[model samples]
Target: MPDPERDIASRYREHTGRKRTYILTGFVLLVVTAVLSIAVGSVDIPPQDVVRTLAGYSVSTNWDNIIWNVRLPQVLTAIVAGAGLAVTGMVMQSILRNPLGSPFTLGISNAAAFGAAFSVIILGAGSTSSRVGDAVTINNPYTTTIMAFLFAMLVTAVILAFSRFRGTSPEVMILVGVAMGSLFTAGTMFLQYFADDVQLAAMVFWTFGDTARASWEELGLISAVVAASVIYFTFNRWKYNAIDAGDETAKGLGVNVEKVRLVGMMFASIVTAIIVAFLGVIGFVGLICPHMARRIVGDDHRFLISGSIITGSLLLLSADTAARIMMQPYQLPVAVLTSFLGAPTFIYLILKGRRI
Candidate 1:
């Protein structure tokens, strides 16, 4: 007879150990990295002040304002946006079974950008953004963000419908997104050409992502979305792991393969849309972070997914901090720095994979 007591004890131990490794590790890393982000800024406000300010204690208004208004929001935007992008990439990879699957490759980000551009450019919600450095600041930032998110959902729905006919083949779905992305890019170029100098300038700045403008209100919305995604994805990790094996295998295992893919696709699109809308087009982190996490924790989404979230948040926060400090009195686009780091690392991974 199987030793029931021994089996139960072993299972319990394994469960606790996994929780510690995945959940505890993620929590610790997030806290440490968050502090590092808080400390590294233009005007140094010690960690104590940051905590004190958060605790409803009084501090210098200048220090208070800079910490609360500027660095805090930027740090949060980077973390939330990074985590969202990374998890979305992982989900796309899960369902598509393609290593290159990401918001960029799948055209979700581009689609969201196109929607935002239409609102500002064609419809004139704020100002026509067609050229470089031409930013059409609108009365409501969230209004433009909502438009991007909704449009991205529309695009995802179309992709889902196509995928049903396409038999969920990674190649077919991703190829369609690629063709769609090209079309969107062409449209953006046409708009830029027709735009005058001012609008062109505004368009340029937007294409490159910037985290400097993140505010408390924006942070609240972004955090809520990302936090919910993290939780939802966490519970759904096993389903993702099954899908990774193969859709047929997942279905044989009693998984609702299509439902899972549809839901994952929906959530992933929501994530990409929200991040792209507010943060602009930050590129490559989504692709890089998931690969990095998978390399560290293997293909199991339980650990790999949570690890991706924490690592992405850390990487972006550090990168954004560097962007701020690298050029005194000037802020560079977060996308530029992320691309620099993410692209090289991604290339390294590809080479490493081939060698192995």
Candidate 2:
């Protein structure tokens, strides 16, 4: 005779164990990929030397400078940016109950781009040099970052305001986001049309999603915000889990649907704004990483968030590494590599009738 309760408990334990294993494996891979990113760059440094330099050992002045002054910062930026975007995407999808919801899909990226463009073109904030490569090496990045953050918040405000009257239906919210995105994109193009060559070059570089622009100061700010947001999300994981079961069910479970949606949107918007403002507009990581996470860990927000963070960090670190080495002395935009990688997978998912 089978002990049904005992059998059920055994299966539950197995399921939980599998999820933990997936998260642990994914995190280990993320660390390895980060190490590889630090080592494999335009100027190759051995993995051992890279580790030594990081630990405050003198591995030649030039090697130290390259590792400490350049590669390490970029690696940190990619890891943080990837984790932030991936988590934001997961939150957006959960709240909207739409598989396609992302910062890019919601037009938040376009809003950030417009803000950067406004800072460069109208405010005369960034470098006016004719050199495209020097665009990321701007003297006053704070102005551009502030502008991007403001505009991103503006977009969030618009969506929330509209949702008040129309109700927060998934289709309605997505449509509103698409419309907002198109408007912001058009505004960016308009700014570019009247800009001078130097300003135009700077604006163009700002849109390429390069991580080499990261400085220690910017990384610190981003780290603080992302850490806070992730903590908040973690605490509310059960609420999100309830919400994921649909609004009516969530309400029945005593979840405040509107409150959660509002707070989640604001938090996600802030994370997206900070990352896009600094790294330009890296797409696909936000949109695809969540789906990848869900596929691996199922719909449990606890495991899903952890998996998304690890997977996102891995994907961005790998893409950035490819961008650095693929063109030798000349680096391709990290955005280009991510797009190339993401587009194929995206199309394949759609064609295979995967739930996206």
On lDDT, the candidate that comes out on top is: 2
The TM-score leader among the candidates is 2
True-structure lDDT of candidate 2: 0.86
Cα lDDT tens digits for candidate 1, 77-132: 88888888888888888888888888677787777777766665665555444334
All models: lDDT?
0.77, 0.86
TM-score per prediction, in order, is: 0.87, 0.92
Where does candidate 2 clash, by residue pair?
none
Q: Model 2, range 1-356, lDDT digits (tens) per residue?
A: 54566778888888889999999999888877777788887678888888787788888999888888898898898889999999999999999888888867678999999999999999987665545445344446888888988898899889888889888777777888899999999999999999987788778878889888789899888888889889998988999999988899999999988888878888998899889988889989999888888888988998898888888888898899889898777778789899889999778767874666
- Runs with alpha carbons beyond 4 Å of true place in candidate 2: 1-6, 126-139, 351-354
Off by over 4 Å in 1: 1-19, 125-143, 353-356
Shift in Å, residue 178, candidate 2 = 2.0
